[model samples]
Target: MSELVDLRTSGRTAVITLRRPAKRNALTIELCDLIRDAATGAVADGARSLVVTGEGTSFCAGADLDAVYGDTFREALYGMLQTLTTLPVPVVAAVNGPAIGAGTQIAIACDVRVAAPTAAFAIPTAGNALAVDPWTIRRFSLLAGNGAARAALLGLEKIGADRAHALGLADRLGDLDDALAWAAQMAELAPLTLAYSKQVLNTVFEPELDAATAAELGKSFDACWASEDFAEARAARREKRKPVFRGL
Candidate 1:
């Protein structure tokens, strides 16, 4: 496993921590792949519940924009998120700090979220002329609310911990220890019941996309990644200037 992703077990609860604090635990292709592997390993090791958190102040700033525009990166990124969502064991997100862009997606992928006072969530894709997948939009809307989703995705506003909990985005307001305690408590529950409930919830709430809709969403998503604005956003980041997007 990559050193960027750390996995360990606490009793029957597995903990996965993103370890690159210098970068605010931003997601990269390697980090995403490692996260999926770690989750799988935890399941194989008989973990009954899981908690994901970052090692430093920031839970995850987002995807590394420098490497964000590409098929490989998107595949790894969505694959990890999907894996966490489908994992039989219940997963909890310990949002220790800011969870922006892909970080917000990571928190939503888990079954529940525990946010620190400093925790905040945002997806500023519109500002950069980039876009998240359809599932991200739907999952976020379902967990939070259409109003909150619009505020985050369209208004580009950051939702803080108190507001997040009030909006139903964060299930609770607490830190890493609270998340672990919740996970540990979940580990002692009836495994089959939890698994079945999770399966039902995912399936009922998020049905499979039809082929035509899937294709249309895919084409639109690919266009954003291949757009000039996406490149400009990355370049502007490197230049330490604001990105001026042209809706190409």
Candidate 2:
């Protein structure tokens, strides 16, 4: 229902497009909530499959820098990503262009990805002195590989569409049309079976955490958000210079 996101249904397939080309469809708290609603709305509208894509040259550049450090931003972000992952029907990403940071997380949250030649994925959190949730790290490693994860997360390398497909980050390399077609085909499958398999896969892959481990992970993630390095990164952006992180 939000102007920032468009939802349309064709037969049993629903398409959700991020519509802010001016900002490369970057996520804001509002945008994240809209996306989460769109996914749920599509399913409620009898959609058996869903395709997520962007309206512009970039799928999503990342979160808007101005709002990225807000207290509620992480909750909004992970809520949307979790909705995508837990959706009853299959969700496919049509990566039309660069999917950076939270954008990469969105793509991975989907059940399958169809990337355009221009599509590339990267989570430059380390470079920006930020951190992603643990589920994102695990999903990236499982979908791609631990080696690819190390390269992207540790080495700070961008994985192009071809490399993504080869590394299993992308299930296929194709354009929007191809992605839509794939979604339509998936819609024809038995809904209950698809939902059952999806639930099982998600449950089996999830890691159970005790209170101590959970507290530690939360502390670490919160530290990055509160760190002086993140402040420096924002300052550097405004100053039009490279950030010098002290890891403080």
Q: Give the least accurate 10-residue stretch of model 1, judged by summed lDDT.
A: 64-73
- Give the Cα error of residue 47 in candidate 1, in Å: 0.3
Q: What would the per-residue lDDT of candidate 2 be over residues 42-72, giving only the tens digit for each residue?
A: 9998999999999989999999997885579
List of clashing residue pairs for candidate 2: none
lDDT of 2 at 215: 92
Q: Clashes in model 1: which pairs?
A: none
Model 2 spans with C-alpha error above 4 angstroms: none
TM-score per candidate: 0.97, 0.97
Number of backbone collisions per candidate: 0, 0
Which tens-of-lDDT digit does each residue in 1-248 have in candidate 1? 55798888999999999998999999999999999999999999899999999988999999987767588998999999999999999999999999999999999999999999999999999988779999999999998899989988999989999999999999999999999999999999999999999999999999999999999999999899899988888888889999998787
